[model samples]
Target: MAWHDRAPDSFTATLWDGIGDVWAEIRAHPFLTGLKDGTLDHRAFVFYVIQDAHYLREYARALAVCGARANDVAGIRMFCEHAAGAIAVERELHESFFADFGLSEADVAATPMAPTNVAYTSYLLSAAYGGSYAEAVGAVLPCYWIYAEVGRELLAAGSPDSRYQRWIDTYGGEEFAEVVSQVLDAADAVGPSLSEADRAAAAHRFTTTSRYEWMFWEMGLRRETWPV
Candidate 1:
């Protein structure tokens, strides 16, 4: 069977279809499994949240770059909203988790970026600065798409821990799903007009970022730190 058997006919869908193994790996990742069952360590969860806070700051900047480069008013406005929402709304979620986890602002600020976090955000920033609009969108899409999917899956399985449940509900709720849908719509609008080379680049960005998504979860599970 195809990876994205039910996916609609669009570049994002095609990119997703081509990355079956990566998606499966993400779904089966120990971090996600532990999260689903509420068996994950609190320290590990805290580490994940800290690293994610760092990631979101850079992600928001990349989104702003995308907005600045967008050709259409709607695309520009959509990306601007997304950029603001990432910082305003998602960062607020992180702040709430920080309080629950006993993580101070200084603690999060002092947290060094793991190798994987650095690589993932660097790739995104590079794409945003150097690639076309489609490529930028593709690079960022996996973050939203994967989290939304994982959130729904974990929520359905039911977390025994309220902390874990809160995290799950934030991403799994209808509001976040709508955000993902808006992003998908933006990608589809730009996809059909992309040149063949641009399309290929966008697919590569999508696939590469999807791998990073899995690595991100693994980084969290390990509470990854700089090896040096």
Candidate 2:
């Protein structure tokens, strides 16, 4: 079986398969290929890092909401703590990049969210705040799952650029994989309880976000901007 098909659980397996096309496109995206080989443009990487910092803030909020809606103590603890980790842990990396590039808070503030980033984050926030825990989980899962998968793959390929290597190491490392597993386990735990409608809704959420994950890479690769 392909690596993408080797999901952690049956529920996650379905979610994984549901968007196979998106996954293929992600795998084929120039941004990812360039990243693996250290050929990606510095401008694209910079654009991605800034947009990601913004994304993580909104993601933390969605996660906190997931924690609030969690039915179990474990789920609550995981979501809430992971929420903190998103900001604290990931922000450290972003901050270092900011320093390297001589960017200040004011600089980040002045940078507009690319249209795709805006749409994607808005979709995530809506799913998180307007839906059930399962729904929120579905929406957020692709970010965890795809990054870990890509990170590991890219790490194995190895980049010549230490800058890209650092990112590859961060996501591809065991720590991030463990984080992905926890979320997959959560999906499995809740899978059986979801009603048919809820399950379908969650599935839709997964597919949609998975596509956004691809578009995100495309946005960075192309250096997307507002036409108006």
Candidate 3:
């Protein structure tokens, strides 16, 4: 009856299914729902983009770390390419949005990390530095998997806002889906060999990051900032 009790052959599938409720919450979150409906505040969306630009810098570094630590050359190359591709996407996407939002290079550099952004990126960096290859992959998987899923869902439902539609199409497109598949395959490769304890640890990483994914949307909706 519990979520994780359902049998799945692949550990990645199992981990994903176990977090069904979390995914549901994400899909229904007002931030995302508003985006779908073209009702979300423009300022909030801009804030999300600015914070995401900040997050992607650290995320690329984390990917590079994972690539360096991978045992197989193919895994190393895949991760490294993903890392580079992530940066390239970040630059292109954010720059495209900058004129729309009147955001300059200095403005982006001056923006502080929101509380959730700090927490999410810090957790990922620590995981990459301290955890095994399996755990590192787990920690990073949700960003790819969740975004891809959300992108596809948004595309299907259709966004009235061109900006929102562009965001959705980028992740929902074939190229990004291929990247997500590669990451999933990489996780699957390392997962089977993990000890039970390590596997559980990896699942925990996946679940925690998934929660952060939800909080990230919430953070954007609120335009969250530190109180102190």
Enumerate residue pairs that collide in model 2.
Answer: none
Segments of candidate 1 deviating more than 4 angstroms: 1-7
**lDDT string, candidate 3, 37-131, tens digits:** 99999999999999999999999999999999997999899989989988897579978998888889899999999999999999999999999
Model 2 TM-score? Answer: 0.95
- Cα lDDT tens digits, model 2, 1-228, are 333445555788988878888888998899999988889999999999999998899889888888898889999999999999999999999998888888998898789899999999899999989988899999999999999889988988999988888999999998888888888888888998989899899999999999999999999998899999
**Among all windows of ten consecutive residues in candidate 3, which has the lowest summed lDDT?**
1-10
Give the CA lDDT, 0 to 100, for residue 88 in model 1: 93
- The full ranking of all candidates by lDDT, starting with the best, is 2, 3, 1
Give the per-residue Cα lDDT of candidate 2 at 71. Answer: 84
Which whole-number lDDT from 0 to 100 does residue 215 have in model 3?
97
How many residue pairs clash (N, CA or C atoms closer than 3 angstroms) in each of the candidate models, in the order given? 0, 0, 0
Off by over 4 Å in 2: 1-9
TM-score of each predicted structure versus truth? 0.95, 0.95, 0.95
Ten consecutive residues with minimal summed lDDT in candidate 1?
Answer: 1-10
How much is the lDDT of residue 216 in candidate 3? 93
Colliding residue pairs in candidate 3: none
The C-alpha local distance difference test score for the whole of candidate 1 amounts to 0.88
